[model samples]
Target: MLKCDFQYQHADFSLNVELEMQQSLLGIVGVSGSGKSTLLKNIVGLLKPDQGYIQFNQHILVDTRQNIHLPMHRRKITLIFQQALLFPHLNVKQNLCYAEKWLAPSERKFQFDDIVDLLDLNGLIQRKARQLSGGEAQRVSIGRALLSSPNLLLLDEPLTGLDVQLKQQILPFFKRMKDELNVPMIYVTHHLEELEYLEADTLQLNHGQLQHN
Candidate 1:
């Protein structure tokens, strides 16, 4: 379970939201700059809230009152950014192995070969990140995150740069990851079609505040 009841004040706007959700894909939908990404950043511990708390699976990840704020890496949450930010210098195999370094020997759950097969990345393993197409790069990015074995995943408009056909092609992989992996996800997008495809429990935001619970 994940619960958030927090507020942050900006120079021109204030974001206040409260939500509770379980292990399921939760979609955050809104126009650009409606606090959708802001809320995601907070959940991932990239941004701190001025008040209230963020609890994940009963662990107090953030609590202003208790002065508790776990660092981004300590949150066990992986974020897939708008751009598939693969390291330009690294090959697909190297990028996938980077996250494995963070796991303890006993805690390492995912195997490299399994991830390559799951993401259909066998052919691209030796290719450099810069050599991949847009869709391929995104696949590598997702595979990298999965290799980390994250408890929660945040996808912030991951399809933004892709064309319609590419979006359709990659979306099934997202669904496969959700169903096969059972990893909870928070997907942020403005496109209603994406929401329809995801069929996720949704929270609507407008003007930096949640309009729907």
Candidate 2:
């Protein structure tokens, strides 16, 4: 289970939310700048809340009152953004390998070839990050995140800017990934069609707060 009750205030906006979810894919639906990304960042430990706590499967990642905070890496949560954000100096294969060291000793769940095949990146393995198209780069990024065996996977508008043709090409792999992985996921998007595809429960946020319980 995941439990989050936090509030973060910045110069431009404030985010306040409380949620408790299980091991299922949950969609965080909101428009751009609706604090969707901000909420995910706080859960991942990038932005500490002014006063609140987050607990994932009984492990406390943050508790401002207790003065406890865990670094992003140790939280076992992976956040994928709008961009692939791959290492500019590395090839597609190398970018995936960069996350291998973070895997647990028993977590040989997915290997290089498995990921390559899963994301349909067989031909682009040796190519540089800059050489791949938008959809391809995002696929690579997802593969890299999977290799680390994250407990909670968060995606922030991953389909943004891609054309319909590109989205059609890339969405199947996402469906496959969701079906194959056992980890819980929070997919953030502004598109209603994405919800139809994901069929996950929606947690709608407006401005900086959840619209319904």
Residue 189 shift from truth in candidate 2, angstroms: 0.8
lDDT of 1 at 117: 86
Q: For candidate 1, give the lDDT.
A: 0.88
- Candidate 1, residues 132-189, lDDT tens digits: the string is 9999999999999988988999999999989999999999888887777778999989
- Alpha-carbon lDDT, every model: 0.88, 0.87
Per-residue lDDT, model 2, residue 57, is 93
Off by over 4 Å in 2: none
Give a tens-digit lDDT track for model 2, residues 65-113: 9999999978889999998999878999999988887666687567778
TM-score against native, each model? 0.96, 0.94
- True-structure lDDT of candidate 2: 0.87
Whose TM-score is greatest here? 1
Worst 10 residues of 2 by lDDT: 102-111
